[model samples]
Target: MFQNSSFFQNFSTLGKEDTPKSQWIVEDTIANWWRPNFDPPRTLGKEDTPKSQWIVEDTIANWWRPNFDPPRYPYIPAHVTKPKEQTKLFLVQLPDKAYFAVPKNFKLVAAPLFELFDNSNGYGPLIASLPQNLSRFNFLYNPP
Candidate 1:
């Protein structure tokens, strides 16, 4: 079971009200985004392959799967693994084509800022290197 928050967050918004379906669900949507060195349909070579059948199988074997020598991300006890109750954001679309959502109490007045990385391999890598700028947020939370 592949479990990663950032990995699934992208596709999570697809059927939501605020998401632009036309852009995401274009005719032959998979082909629109698929290309060599971008979204290749298969692994490069069987001769070059090692550890597992697919490249991701290696990742799961090393990181996600439990009971290895190094023990990467061991399964948390059920008591600790219980899901926390979280406020859900309701997507509200404006007539002017702006998207906004508010979770429980706080008001989100500003429009979302989307930062596109030219070198992003995927959301996993992109989110890992996020918040490129802290200066912009200094006004919001300043140390005394």
Candidate 2:
């Protein structure tokens, strides 16, 4: 299921007899995305640190790297850099009038149009929220 191209730089030489297995290491794909949480006696008590290839030594939330026994999934996004209070959080939902009185003239808004769907590739597009819309708020949409 994993992409080996991200795991090895010299992928062609890996199966050869002369190439040492240790050199098979390449830049981690996960590292390209989120920075991991690592802190020291040095700065701010929280810092995003690079995870070691071998998780047996460090406490990094890794899924495929460690080669650990009893597998572990990386904590689904721990915001090491951004805390909840420091974040500009907002809540968007259906209009209050919709719950109180369902309008016969109400239109249905699809969540997929807003790019709200589970992208795990495990299943088809999910999170298709059928929110009741008054069709009052028009949006500029560039459909995919």
Write down the TM-score of every candidate: 0.16, 0.13
* Candidate that would win on lDDT: 1
Predicted candidate 1 versus true structure: per-residue lDDT over 1-144, tens digit per residue: 012243343311111121211243322332232222122234466555221111111111111212222322323334533322211122221132322222233232221224423323433332322234222333334355
lDDT, candidate 1, residue 78?
49
Positional deviation of 139 in candidate 2, in angstroms? 24
The weakest ten consecutive residues by lDDT in model 1 span: 53-62
* Each prediction's number of clashing residue pairs: 0, 0
List candidate 2 segments past 4 Å from native.
Answer: 1-23, 27-72, 75-144
Best by TM-score: 1
Model 2, residue 5: C-alpha shift (Å): 22
Evaluate all candidate structures by whole-model CA lDDT and list the values in order.
0.26, 0.24
Model 1 reaches what TM-score against the true structure? Answer: 0.16
